[model samples]
Target: MLFAHDTEASLAAAAELVNTAHETPDGLRTPADVVAFVDRWSYTGRVAGDAEELAAVRAVRPRLERLWHADRDEVVELTNAMLRETRALPQLVRHDTWDYHLHAVPPEADLAVRILVETGMAMVDVVRLEELGRMRICAAEDCDDVLIDLSKNRSRRFCDNGCGNRTNVAAYRARKAGG
Candidate 1:
């Protein structure tokens, strides 16, 4: 794997969270949407299941999104800022079916803070390994989604929202038309 399981998971979750804001209808429109996101991402913590909690999580999307397009130094600055802002204290912990992984904030911390800290922790590994290029914006001509290229060849140029397939199909059709 390009990164540890937890780091990859955190990066993927962060990307999905950011893409929600880019979705046509704004994927996170309600508390239920927040709940669904947490459940999907397998985040185990104190969930308030309220509007405030939903708003807080939604507010974090843009900040995390910036990391995808940041330069190496900018990523370091933003990640360090996130860790500091969240008062992150990294510790190894095991929960649920997950093996030992780093948890920088307590489960009871605000969900938004947890999201930021988790992403920051993951980015720490990315920065350490000098793998910042793996964080990328989708290559689809009309999409603005972000993705982490976990592929061994580092050829992942599209998000998981079917942009790759769409691009491929368009290319095939254009070739057939020209032929």
Candidate 2:
């Protein structure tokens, strides 16, 4: 694996969070939506289940999205800011079929803070390895999705939500018509 299993999971979760901001129409417009998202990510924590929690998580999405195009120094600064803001203190704990892994906050911390700390810890691994480039924006011309390129050959160039397939089919049709 390009990174620890949990790191990869965190990265995927972070991307999912960002993608939610780009969702059609309503787009994560409620606290219940936030709760459902946390449940889907298996995030264990205290959620206010109110507008405050929803706003905090929505705020985090753009910051995490910025990391996709940031330089190493910028990424370091942002990651450190996240750690500082959340007051993260890494502790190893085993839970739910998982072996020992870092948990920087109590399982009952605020949902936004917990999500920030977890994602920051995983980003620490990426920054340390100078592999932040693996965090990328989609290559599709009109899409703003973020993705992690974990492929050994670094061949992943688009988000998994069908943009790549659509782009490929359009290119193929263009070629056939020009022949």
Residue 76 local lDDT, model 1:
94
Q: Could you estimate the TM-score for every candidate?
A: 0.97, 0.94
lDDT of 2 by residue, 34-97 (tens): 9898878877757788999999889889888887878999988999999998889999888886
What lDDT tens digits, residue by residue, belong to model 1 across residues 2-74? 8999999999999999999999899999999999989998997888889999899999999999898889999
Against the true structure, what is every candidate's RMSD?
0.9, 1.3
Candidate 2 weakest lDDT stretch, 10 residues: 19-28
